[model samples]
Target: MEEAMDGGVRFSSLRFISDHVGFQGTIKTSPSDFIVVEIDEWGQLVNKALDEAVYETSKIEPEPCHSVKKPKLNIQNVSIEHESHGEASPAATRYADRDQDHEAGSENEGSVNGVTSECEKGSAGLLRSLLDEKTHTLLDRFASDVKGMWSSKTELTEPSLALSLGKVLDKKQRAALHSAVRQEFPFLITAGSNAEVVVKPSPEYKELCHLVSEEEALGFFKYLDARKENSKFTFKPDTNKDHRKAVHHFLNKKFGNLVETKSFPGRDHSAGNPNTAAITVRFREKARGKRSRLECERRKAVCTAFTLQKENLEMFEAISFLAVKLGVIPSDFSYAGLKDKKAITYQSMVVRKVTPGRLKNIEKEIMKKRMNVFNIRPVGDSLRLGQLKGNHFEIVIRNLKNQINDSASLRERILEAIENVKNKGFVNYYGPQRFGKGKKIQTDQIGLALLRNEMVKAIKLFLTPEDMDDPVNKAKKYFLQTEDAKGTLSLMPEFRVRERALLESLHRFGMTEEGCVQAWFSFPHSMRIFYTHAYSSRVWNEAASYRLEAYGTKVVKGDLICSDEDAGEHFPSSKVHLVTEEEESANTYTVHQVVLPVLGYNVQYPENKVGQWYHGVLSRDGLQASRFRVPALKLNVPGCYRHILKRPHNVSHRLVRPDPEVEVEGSHADDAMPSLSLSFDLDASCYATVCLREMMKGDI
Candidate 1:
């Protein structure tokens, strides 16, 4: 980090929390290797330091292999801005912020809407703008990385981009990434030093990408015939743009005469599985004691849950007005799945009213915005998470670590982990990491969510930054603060609802709650919001390192179950008080009631399904819950390796190199097709791959 002399751009201001933010400035890739670092925020260039970039040493780790040489698949995916339009929904105004809300925001701002325009109107809308700075950076990184390893003219059993991005890296790395990508400013890190600038995808650039489900996307392939036919490839990478890119051009040049590479774009950007993804959510009425949250759905002559087009309106923005636009929900509308920002998605949203005009206003608004009009029919059934009998995750693992000498051993280990996670089990973690490094946003979000829920008192007591709370503060020293415990806890009440909904929809499994949890969410049946603690003698300490922006859990009771003993070991214990009312010397630091998921061969049901597995589930008759509410709150889990020590003593040079693959890694849903994923999602966003990554990382 550059020492500041009054006017300067600080490194802390730019680095991302969990980024492989490679390269120093403007994401310029070298001709040989891709520069990697975490770019959560960028340091403003100070006039003085600009002329004096000194050098500092990094505490680099020793690994079996360092250099990587990716295969020359010569596969190139060029992304441009994706566009959508939605003008119909009058309620679809700008997002509500503090200023906007004070200026008289509408009741529908936070409510659930059926659909936004097929193309536009949401911060997380379909196909993030490639023009956006962070998203673009992410995409560019992939493009650059692919350039280094892939040569389009190669022959292989089967391959794809998503495979590379979703495979390769460890589960922890992927979890460091989340679902929606960062458009700009990744919370990146490198060799224990902050990079000079933010390395997130360029949010400023409009982003265009495939939003289709993997199954469907993989269906569209660069057929061997196409490889045979694509010899006359016209597309090529800009040599001056990225470093890894040469790999593509070079390999293609070498084997272009022998292999063929074709690009076939499918609907939703490319091919995606048509196997419908149906979710039944049970949400509570917004108002306190307003009965179960509204459960609104499409009445397509038959009773089905309400489905929404991703772009219809902003989900986060519309949280305040679900009732007026979609009709009153009985608080029974809880869902297991969360829709994505790409393409048109089909999933049931909840609502209470089931008449014809139930969603007339919403429907009318949808039409105006050009949003896809799907049904919001009611269901004879209630939807829930883990209700779909688990996802059939199928993805392509590409551009594996260049050092793998025995493909068989690597593949075996990869598959073994899946099975290991299943038997050894894993946690059912949330994939959103937007809360920033050390889960600062998650802390604030959880604190605020609790405050909004009238749990202000609890928020105050648990989230209070005792001595050292800010993840960025240099003086403060409560390392446990880095765990994002508050954020994890905050998401749970809603998780309860989500899981319940999963049970309602699938009826394939039943998850039992572990009874009442602790007031601070430090007990079982609760989610552990790890703070990336910096303290020692704690469970989450650095010795037990956790990836930034990742969620960890254990299963105490649920449809998804394994041995009870494994629960504690898999997830941290609850923070407890020696006595119920005693405010003693010892700190409360145990995290309990975690529900872990199993993966791979150890899976009990869906014998043929692949990926990380969920051990137990919400059984058919298990306390038939109507709604699930995830509420983030403050709690403590110490020693999480979230404390980032800025390189106060070092200067910059001989930058670190990026790992070859941060991509698709999973077993076949049924071995019906070769899986596919992208590498850019590497060290980036895990939610993008959702079920695919979860399969590999899920806590059973």
Candidate 2:
């Protein structure tokens, strides 16, 4: 079999198992035309409706967890210099003005400790009307005590102020008393149960008192003590860029010349741009000279698993959107696999430190965006890639080339193809998607460039201008001709994030060789590895084709077979056994049991002609087995094995006449075209397109 060329890269010599002429049609006529439901490791379909009962029962209210403490101060002392009164007393005029402001803003200020301003105002009014003159006098004395404690210069302990409300019979009266105390002393943290209320200084208030007492101590820098090793903190990677900018601005404003904040690209390449970066705040070298310590207790990790159903959204974009909504970084989220971007997909995802209640609350919002989340519950472990049993696909192949008017012929043709697939299976080649779309330079080409240590060529492949007349291509063309990163960026759209990121790095650092290498590193780690993986897939496809042509369904000597015990594991190469001459003569292994290695430094080639063919193929491409280990790039292709063939499970098909009344985009319904609908389940990493290609005998 000869390789076919469609995209920039060749198909690398793939062969078909079925001998049928095959039918022609188009898949994904609409987003709903292709449906995918993930089958989890437990063999349960990840459907939102199926988990409704569990979701409803598992719903929990968010706990009152003050994970992020507000830096805003509720208590401040301002010295007023009155010409008539010379210098106004610190305790009298300041307290009186503060009390007036609190009363005036009681109905309009934002929420305090989850209590609405309306509730706070109403409760305060009720308390005022219910309390007697003697009670008011006692409250005033308590307020004075609180004021005196805050005014003192000595190191402050937690201020304790308690007043008995004399066993109020009405529950509403006791609630009103609690609100009144909160309104009068906003800095106090209050706790109420039954008829009693205990008031103490808030964490913010205590910190404020400490700052006032120790005027010599630097503000935020004191927390970053140089004596304490590993004292730095990194903000979550999924933190919004705007929010991060605001934090940087705030730090510069408050602790001017005392601290520095630096942003580094996040390790999680699975997230889209902006969310793909993280910020680190640290004390400046000059500020680190002072010796001070501040300690923070770490919160325990919580992983909440949920089923996310999305329509026409890429996995990284969806994760980034969810991360922004949930106020977490993309790295905090884990999923079993990446689903299709052009179809409706349901898959399980787990996010750390997020509660089920919080995820549940976002369902309506996510639904508005063509996505929904449900089946939310706390799981002990996080989901990893390839953790699922497989994916179930319900695909509609529409606009049949010749069978539009002949339902009987369409049915017969589909059944014949299905039977062939069931008996012999399709060639297990990496789908065209692995090579990327259109006539643009394929990912494998970029991988080859990287392997050869050609940094500039790899970048040029990424930024090369296609023949399209779009603004993005024009921007690339402009950069190539003029090398004006800033000018090119202005013409590019904001949504073209990867291109913009590269241009920005080039603009900042200039177009030196080191700058280009740095620009390459600007991409997420996963993206950097994807290029090499595609190259490996290219080699594997060619090797698989050669093996089938030479050995034709025979499990010969040196063939690697993974044991049944290792079959259940995600990556079973660790337990693979090589067939001996005796085993080959005895026919101990079947063709279905054989596996092929995706060329890598650590992988063992078969001790046969097929293995020798791998070297020939690599040598032709100017690569060797050892080149997979690129230490300079921090990339190591340790390699893995994949099954040489796959037969889809529970295959079924039907032919349907299009409804005259229903309108489907890109569908020939008015012509009464018959559509071929297929339902099948494939194991993890197997491309469904390859199965379709075997039946249709057309380029996918």
Candidate 3:
């Protein structure tokens, strides 16, 4: 098989779809140079502003009845009433008496309407005495509003209110006012500043006010518990002891014996520390039996689907950042698929138990991370991988003047290349990202070793370095030579997560075979499986090249063809059928319709010469089909089939001069160098880089 080396990794020499003189250009000059927007299953482009109107309209449900009116409390009217009458209300009289007691330096405490006079002792008592008749009337009206809203169960459109105190108060006075408010109205929470006192309903108060009901809470818990295998869902950790206590108290008061509450130290706590603990609420043993009638009417779990637009961040990295901000685990989020790290991309993400309001709240924080999310709306189900139809790409290739003869020639060549790609398509080879940029030992080499049950060899290959002079590599070398994991770790950078993990494991377990294996296993399961995936990709690449060489643009007998009924479906390998002699004679199938199986134990290879090539390739790597099913290693890969060719749609290109204001490296300010802008749409899992490789006819 023809082989070529790129970036120190050997790959199959892929054939080009277009036969034309190639031009040279540089891509990804900036994050904005490449833009990717995912095309969903319905062929709708996923955009940052897509369905914005729908999201806006769907945020709040309409009121049940238009006749239901909110009781209005006018503080200005109360001020007028106080001005007309000289006598104060009974509540105001009690507050004045407490203020006098505090000024008299009384040691004995008094209570007024469940509020301790001790809370009115210091600056708060002085502030109350300083309040004029109109201010006292305003406080009375605010209390009236709170009671009316709480009793009537009116929908809380503005859950919080900020009451502006006429004069500025010091920090201590503000703190005292906050404490007095809490003592005066336990259901309402308050935060005070110099100018105003902000009051809002607490979680318990909200529940009591019918924002959520006891039966609704129980129903939600039942729904969540039914879906969980272990019936365990932990709440977000809180460092505040009062927050933890409040959660336990609220659950106990509401659910009573129906649910149990437990408090455990947070995951990131220090030993024997109670301050860093969290509370978890679950169904009690008595409540875990047969479902009650109310439980039987459990509501389905709803998820929020949003369009996430990120710049220069890996898909997982962006998701993790968002998960932290949303106060949910990363596993709770789902996406159609991963996108390029360095390019600006828009993709849809779905997360359960996260409301659109919560996502909207974190928009500012997320924007600081070079990411933004919008068009958030409720969805019935979470998005699954490979659910997307494809992705639309807008790419700009710069520095074209160095390669092309003239502007006219460049335009002609680009037009011809675009037409060729639209008509014939390119070889569907896995991109270099699949194997990683391992110079000394590619990921597939480690996979081959793992398949042969060489754990230590695989570990060594993973840790070994190609550049000895690099700081991280030097640390690796030191660890290899002296087995000083701790010393090497000191020299290593914190950002090198994989390296640091292995070193830490070695330091703890010692550098024995078991320790090495433990260090290897310490990696995430996805990472461990990635090595084998790289191996499969390598084999598929070679097989694809061999298929093209043996039978160029021809569909032969025994070739696997996906049935027309399943052609539009993703992962259509299950509907694959081998072409018979009669079908081959009919000459209905083309090479574009052919499919190749990635190496796996359960997969069916093509019944042609290309299938025979798989045996030779695996054998050369000291592997066989049976080796793929390794139970002990959990490496049983039920490999899937991929199309042999990919035809991009809506292919268009234009040549434009570089912007005079924008500075492109190697491009002079005075020089009007032409840049190629390409727009195309490729099916899901097809690499745009591969398409570019075809047009460039060189290593991308």
Candidate 4:
């Protein structure tokens, strides 16, 4: 184990399933080579749903707030004074970020009330147009920046807005002045000479109020900031009302409860409508299937089936974008499994509680983008992972020359390869997609870091930007490489929202290993689960390969042999047979099960040759049976079993008609070569690429 850790190769190694193939060919030279059509649970293409099904609406629930201790203030070295200016000065001028330094005035020399630098509006005119364009501009800026301002040591600009502390006040007195400051900032109001007068700030001034704590500012900024940052990252809310409501809900939740005010929670208005005092705040109801199908059509969930024709989008990300556009969470939708990001895949998806009319609207919006990407309809029920009846694939193998020029001989070779795969099947190895895509630092590496209690290392792995050509990302990557969390965070773009959230957490919680781990957990729960599973899968794939090599197509005594049909059931609890001597002899040529262990705490291997191999593999990776039971991290991986063998069903093929135009740019049209098209179906958890590799019978 120690040696393996030192080597680093222990975690990076992966094994292929079909080490023994009889044919030699190539496949997938283009995105079109692989086509996946998801078959729904009812054994039909997931296309659309019936009109009778009702749409389910998710209720908003109040989330319990986690208590974060406030940082204590050091007032010993700070100086405070009381100054009474009988009359208020004019509002300060607005300047650009760079221009602020050149044009300066004495401290608090300008207006006690802030001015509207953009519109040149004073407190007098601002009150009249308070709900107009200027208010939105101020709110948007505050929403976009408050989160990043907490740990930020941004230089203080001259105070644009001030509060009238009736008498002289000390630093402690300033810190205590919270209520007026809090309520005033949201309304873009600043202190003025008159007791009730407040003004706007200069447009050029760029800084946070020193009087209030960063934690207090989070009250109004949390949800609004999230919305703004998400918008920048391409998550557009469904409507203006939804945007306001969501922000309001989060604010109330952040402050522990609704504030006692006339306009505490505002009401929802139509799209583009300005919010009134009574904002509508939504809290989720803790109820499952609250309404039956017969109760109300809109109350129950309508399982809408859809197909996505994607070129370059992750399944989760695509769903997130769609959900945001509709003012819903991605969790509101479900799918059987994730697909490749860089492929032209027509895969299945289902969303609950959305109306057909709403779907049509979503479709129109998608169409406006000029992309023929998504198609939607209604189904009776929502789709869950592994609820599908497996996937059917239509593939093309390209860039290979026929070794035999004779058509009959080439066809014979292809048939022989197919026959070999049909009898023996291919290994159900986890593909590269299971690990992190297009990166040297795989998910399993992060999992290992987690297991080792190296939270700092794990967090670093998460933030380590990929080696790419993006200039903005490159700059952020440089900061990350140097372990400069604040610097990287300051430069990080909105698209890197997850990373930004982590940095903010690190800044707030202190950058210790525990803090980093806690910050890491702040990410979406599904992602954390994915990271752990990737490591388990890597171990399973490597072990399966070794087991197959040791006992090739033979059932040894005490070997757990699962049936092909029962393979889909939980393998760990599935029925298995202890091959007796007579049964082994009788089924010598008919042996058909492969055991792939999903490493976890509850795993128990047979005391056979395969058991020894599993133990050896685990030890080499610095892993033990007990390490799988990490209850502290909530990662108790109860080991399971998976059948290593998978054979495609309803297999068929045909020659693809070559285009007469020879679209090869300069190639002669008459000399165009013919291509082959193969189609087949496999069970759930089986990769179509494995089947293609088996048919090709060569190195991929």
Candidate 5:
């Protein structure tokens, strides 16, 4: 009864549902075998955006929110001026000649009188480095306002640090600093009329301007004004760094204690007065938002929607990558279920409170790094997981050599297979993807080890060899065998940063059992949740499979059946009552619901053999009913119900015979295969491959 350490789902175990060898041949020979198109709650496909139309529509001005007022700053006449140490350097001319729109170099500039070729090259390199450093620093420090201020054609705000060199430095230092600024900062052009430098917007600024207009920006800020009243974040007027740091430290300590105690309003029966201690500090009074003149302008957010095209990228991975590239938090992005990595997928997602121009920058960056990844223009509202009704699939099953000679018989066989599925249905087992690939200990094993307080075992599984081909993994295996955490750090590649981080933690925390487990928890919350969920899902799968064999999709007199219209929100199994004879008669043949429990602290078994089977599965795994209640971690898996049967809608098919003339995009025309193009629609959390397996009649 022990789970397979190899992480392979034995198709033989699912024999109760159907025969394993119904048909023989593999699916997913290529990424094209599986295509996923997500459908929104309105029963419509989440379609691709027409790039040109999307761009044009994004440019249309939005109606302004009436609550906001304009500021009284004169930004129209701002211009940049450059002052020379002695004679102006060639860098000055280069800055002046930089194409306004493109931010590119011009060929019209002449060489400096005394500068050598080598010196020019060095200066140019230094300038490039300094410019990059300066740009990144500004971007990070003022992220919210960077899009608007940096790209404005009419405004040039004062630089955070002066570009001037004072008498405290020598002549050489001053000249070097002067040259660096002139080569970079395109804002510094010819001398201006004012005593101080007055920056003027150039063509470069205009090109990178905000996609959301000022009116829209103001509207969003006004909306935030209403949100701020009940917000967890309390804004304070900008203050000294030391004061802010101390306040942050205090709050962190207080919050940590609060979370550990689980103390909220009206739930304060703790022995110690933690709330009184926190209140005595009065940090909230000091940090509370004040009625500032520019309060609304300071915290504006613009939501943007875009169509993402990714080749073999997990939804979370793609979103995380984009967030890092855009210099934003991953929490800013919202998406539905994770997509398959080996398949091409297109889905809708939203980046909240970000300008379309910045979103465009992120898209451009992704294309540059990964030619396969792309994004259409951003448009409207924010997106969330499970906000959609389902997904539509356009799959191709290739190499069907078992077919009959006549087209009529071939068609009938396929239809019969489909019809069998329509009536008999298929068991909803969590696919192999939920566990992970290859013959090694799965994440669920590590999660189970963690739950059992077997920290050393969990760490070993993580560090031990998973992929032999990967040199870094090979090194990890060696170090794990030798029990040398410190030695592994140098061997770890940059791509294996997570492993390196773990090793570093092991070194710092002294390799104690608790320390190792704490180091595991240090990983991203999503990854930790993934490990726990994998284990919970394993238990659920076993229980469901057992119930299927016992019941055979038949409604017994004592059986609990979910209403077809309920959508499996509250599991019928949890609140079971004896089925009436009339109800059993109606459901016996046309039973549409099969509910299975996902194990958690609150989960209790049903009253009968089915319930005993659930408990037996838990016992075999060396887990108690309350094993999910791990207090050390914040992520207590509150498991829920899952539907054990799903059927597709809007089903159709087509046959594509091999031909040089008939070709699909991305696939080579000459390298064609005689394939069946199968299409269908299924609701959220349902796997298309599961449905396809029933129709294809075997291993896929």
Candidate 6:
């Protein structure tokens, strides 16, 4: 109804996605892709001329706070440069990061030619060796980092091998860069499927900044000088390759005794191979244990057994709230994870557990505040950081793109593609968002390192424990490496050797079965989580095999019969009246479904060559979808939440038995580590760390 300076008009229930006007019918895409595209389009529009197009933008206070400006990219003209080549190696990596090649000399320009960093014999020995080592490294890192990774390179320059794989970054590294950089960037996804969006950092920016440290701005400046100062370039590419993995590395002895990682997302799925998403939880407020000396001494007796239960609602909110309730300023209580505002989540807390029942009114107060508690457990030691494992998530997406659009429409095309992917499977290409418009995908480099280590570990120690000494397997593993490094010591030890080490650890950390150091130290914080995006992938493979098996075979809907009581067990059979059980079982098969909610998949009119767009694409062919990947994380029952179980095959578990047969020292002969926990409800893109952070928050 209203017109703008550029003369773009607006209407009810209508929006523009990248110069294209959409109003439910004109454009559409999958929920996740649509969300990303929309955000990108909106961001592009907003950044064009902030003064002319910014929404309700106010003038900034022209304060001269460090005149250094960060990198800036033109959103409209932004396009990721795709790298095209083969497997890369550590020597091939030129850019330096936390673990980057600090020893490497200045990189030569225009090195994309097929020359190897270490070509051997006829080939460039340096290039070949580098490629081999880096390739394995990149792959293993991809597998470890549960959050996934990304890589960014200046458009005009060559990207390192790590950038090509994506997901080689650490949390602190990313945070440090985010804190420093102020300019817009382009994200390139070389590997790994993930959800992300492009937007002008606004409300979230101005507000979140309040939480940033006073030196955060300055710190970023320092970091920028350390990385991009020398390069007069901008942007980079993903080897144009697809599929990258995240790597998890043990980082114990780093946080000390302050905190530890939790094993599972929550009480629901803390057993084994947890299907919880990895969520990162940064401490926003300080702990109660670190308060003033006077307060600590005065309340030492009363505060020792301070336990937080579901009944004690205020106990978990914040130190301020707890201090107010204790007839004194809320201070002194410590916590680990942050719990949800709404839900009756079980939590473990540490407090004085002392005299006169200091937390006497906990039940009454919690009830008054409309909170419920299943139970609260008190332990001898405080839960350190990183003690929690991860969170299981289950979520639903509403208003899915309808498939009714007929007449060879885009909607139909998308449906078909989705069906194929669900059933057969699509190339696990890094989604467009992985290489975001402008964020330095430095993490991908780290992923490469982790993956490399894992592969070596798998090879040296044997893919399975039994194969440790298989010289053939070890050689095979070694062959996979790009470097001449002999063998990996990480997994070099034999079964007995490693068993003895763990037993020793258990002994040092253990005083009693229950009051053991293992339990106290091996909390979620102490453990780094590993998330598996294995379901859709495995399902796709399964569908592929299924389709190949049933390609020409035909069966009707009801071909499979329930039972054939008339037929004897040895000769069980069904009548021909309906599709026979054998016939149905033979021909009728499960269709592969899409991983995300469906929206037609159709290319824009000209984008498709041969004018052969298959199904309708969301928004493009006239359908709207979520701007983010709002996957329906349907969790299986008995899982902490329903969303964690996205696909039927997705299973979460933790090391339960720890292979009891191989008994040794440190590992509690009694309490065993789980392989992985079960899956549970969680929103799409929500990190498991976030959930564990919530659960650990109640711990004093």
Which numbered prediction scores highest in TM-score against the true structure? 2
Model 5 segments more than 4 A misplaced: 1-11, 16-22, 50-304, 329-332, 351-354, 368-384, 403-411, 483-486, 497-501, 507-510, 557-560, 565-590, 659-673
Where does candidate 2 clash, by residue pair?
A: 238-329
Residue range 323-394, candidate 6, lDDT tens digits: 445554322444434343222233333344232355555557645655432223323333322223222332
Shift of residue 56 alpha carbon in model 5, Å? 14
- What TM-score does each of the candidates earn? 0.25, 0.61, 0.59, 0.57, 0.60, 0.20
Instruction: State the lDDT of candidate 1 residue by residue for 1-700, as single tens digits.
Output: 2322222112132212221111111110111112111111122211112112221121112122212212111111111111112221111111100000011112222112321221113324322431346644555575455334423523221112221122112222322222112211111110100111112222111110122222221211111112111112222111222322332343234233323233322223323533212111111123111111111111122223444444434333232244335544323344434333322333344444444355644676655543433444434433332122111111233223212243344344444434433333222222332222233233323422332333433233233343443342321122124433333333323323322222232222211121112343322121222221111112111111221123222111111222222111111111111222121123222222222221111112211111011111122112111111223333222111111111111111221222335333652232232222312211111132322233333211
**Residue lDDT tens for model 2, 1-700:** 6544522225634776568767778897777988999998657898835566654664433323242322211222121111112132322222222211121122211111222244344544655676787876666676566657766744454312344434343444554555465555555544432233444444444443443222211222223211122234445464467766765665455443445677778777555564666666554654433211110111235678888989998776787678778998766788877788789999999998887889998888888878988777876546655678889999988877643344456666777778888877888888877777555688888898888878878888888888999999999999889889999999998767678878898898878777778887666545676788888888787777788888988989988876441242223233467899999999888887778888776576787888888777788778887788665565767576787878889988888887779777865442377778889998877888888988887776
Q: Compared with the true structure, what per-residue lDDT tens digits does model 4 show for residues 284-381?
A: 12111121121234324466666766655566656656776667666667677777665556667777767556766777665543223345655554
Over 4 Å off in model 3, which ranges?
A: 1-9, 50-304, 319-333, 351-362, 376-382, 401-408, 466-470, 482-484, 501-524, 563-574, 630-635, 658-671
lDDT (C-alpha) at residue 460 in model 4: 75
Where does candidate 2 have its weakest 10-residue lDDT segment? 77-86
Candidate 1 vs candidate 6: which has greater TM-score? 1
Candidate 2 at residue 386, lDDT? Answer: 61
Better of 1 and 3 by TM-score: 3
Best prediction by lDDT: 2
